[model samples]
Target: MIIERKQYKLLEKIIFEKLVIQAPFKIPNPMPDEACFLYMLEGQINYKTENQNVSVPQNESVLLKCGNYFSQIKNDKSATLHQIIIVHFHPKILKSIYSSDLPEIFKKPSFIDDKIDLSHINNDFLIQKYIENLMFYFDNPTLVNDDILILKFKEIILLLCQTKNASTIQQILSQLFSPTSFTFKEIIENNLYSNFSLVEFANLANLSLSSFKREFKKNYSDTPANYIRNKKLEKSTELLALSEERITDIAFDCGFKNLANFSHLFNAKYNCSPSLYRLNLKDK
Candidate 1:
C-alpha cells in the first residue's frame, strides 16, 4: 500500500488534540516534524520504523520520535486508534520545561536523536490512565495552560520512565547529548528516485543490510522498497490533486519509470487508475 503525506496547517501556540482516524488501508509516510503518541484503543495498528516494525494491539501504546522514517499498515476491518500528537516549537518547548525546578526526569530533553524504548512499561492500568489524561487535555485544549500542560506532559514521561521495562532514565538521557549521526531525513529528501536500493539505505543508516531490513520491517511492517514506493506514490497523488501537470509528467516527477508503471501502482493502491481517481475527486 502507498503511504500518503497529509499536510496540516501549523499552529502558532501550543496545541493539544486527540485524533480518531480509521486506518486508510494504504500505508502513509512519516510526517517530518510531528512527535506522536499512539494508543491502540480497539484494534490493531502496524507501524514500521527505521529500525523496527511493531504492531500495537488493542490497549498498547507507542511513542514515535520526530524525523524517524515510518509508515503504518492498518488491518482491513475498521480499527479505532486514539492518538495524542504534540508538535513542539523545537528548542522553545524544551527550554520552557528545562528551566523549571521539576524532577531530573522532566529536565531531560523530550526529543531525542535516537528512539527510546517505552515498550517495556507493562502496567496497563497506568497506561490507560495516561491515555485518559491525554483525552482530557484534548477535550479542554483552551483551559490547558502551556506551562501546566508541559508539566503534565513531563509527568507522563516520568511515569512511563518509571515502568519496569522502560530503559533506565540515564540511558534515555544520554541520547540528548549524543551526536546526531544518522541521516534518515537526508535519505528521504535526496533520493526520491525509484532506483535507490535497500543496500544503499542500510549503508546510510550504518546497519548491515540484513539488520536494516529486519529493523525496517519491525518498525514499518513493510520492506524498504515498498516504503519508498508508497511515499513516491503519495507524492504523485498530491500532485495530481493540486497541480495542472500532465499524467506522464507527474509519473516522471514522482520517479516512476513510465506512465504504465505509475498507473499500475496507483490503481493498485487507490483501487482506481490515476485519471479516474482525479476525475472522481473533481466530481466531488
Candidate 2:
C-alpha cells in the first residue's frame, strides 16, 4: 500500500493535503514541524503517538499538536482504504494569523495537547462543507487567492471555536502561538511508557540522535536505552505486584511489545520472570 497525497501549499507555512493510505502498511512516525487539524474522510487507521494509541474512524477529526508520532493502517485482509484531509500550519503561519486584525476570540491562546479529539463535536456537516470549499480551491489552484486562503483558515478556526469543544479548539490556537521546548526529562516522562523508538524520541525532543544521546547521558547519568529499559521493567514489576492485570497487559502498558521479550528483560533485571515475580509478591 502506498501513501498518497494531493498537497496544496497555500502559504509558506500553510498546506492542505488529501492523504490516501492503502491498508496493510504503516507510516513510520512522520512528525511534522507544525500543528495539524486532521479530518478523517474514509476508513479507520490506528494512530500511535508517544502518549496515545487511538482508532480514528471516518468523518471524525483530531487536532494534533506539533510533535513526534507514527500511524498504522492494517487491512486484516479487508478491502477498506483509509483517507484523511490534513491542514498543517507551521508556527509562523499561526503567528501570522494570530497577529492579524481579528476579534478578541482569535486573540485567545491556543493550547497544545498531545491529541485533541474533535469527534464529539456535532458540527461535522458544517466542517465537511468547509473542507469541500477548500477542495474547490484545491482543485482550481489557479483561482486560489492568499487573502481568501487566510480567511478560510480563520473561518475553520472560528467554526471550531463555536463547537462544544471550544475550549480545546482555543487551546489549540493558544498553544500554536506558544510552543514550549520540552526538556530531556519532560520528553522522557511523556514518552517512557509509549512504544516509540529511540529515533522517534530524538525527534520528539527536537534533537539529533547524537545530541539526544549526549543530553540523555548528561541528565540521567545512563544511556537512553538502558534507562528506558530499566524504567519500563520497574514499572512492570510495580504493576505486577500491585495490580491483578495480566502479564501481557502489563508488558504492553510498560512499553514492551511482546510478553516473551518482557519476561526475558524482566528476568534479566530482577532475577525472576514476570509471572514468577508476581507469584513471589503474592506469596509474601
Report the number of the highest-TM-score candidate: 2
Stretches of candidate 2 above 4 Å error?
A: 10-14, 21-34, 44-56, 64-81, 109-120, 135-151, 194-196, 232-284
Q: What tens digits encode model 2's per-residue C-alpha lDDT throughout 1-284? A: 55676766654544677778766444433333456677778877656654566676777777665544444554454356788777776767766666656444435454444454222343377888888787787678788777877788778777777677777666554554555566668778867767778888888778899999999999999999999999999888789988997777678667776779898898888898888888988889
Task: Give the TM-score of each candidate.
Answer: 0.51, 0.63
How does residue 41 of candidate 2 score in lDDT?
81
lDDT, candidate 1, equals 0.56
Worst 10 residues of 1 by lDDT: 1-10
What are the lDDT scores of the predictions, listed in order? 0.56, 0.69
For every candidate, C-alpha RMSD to the true structure in Å = 13.1, 5.8
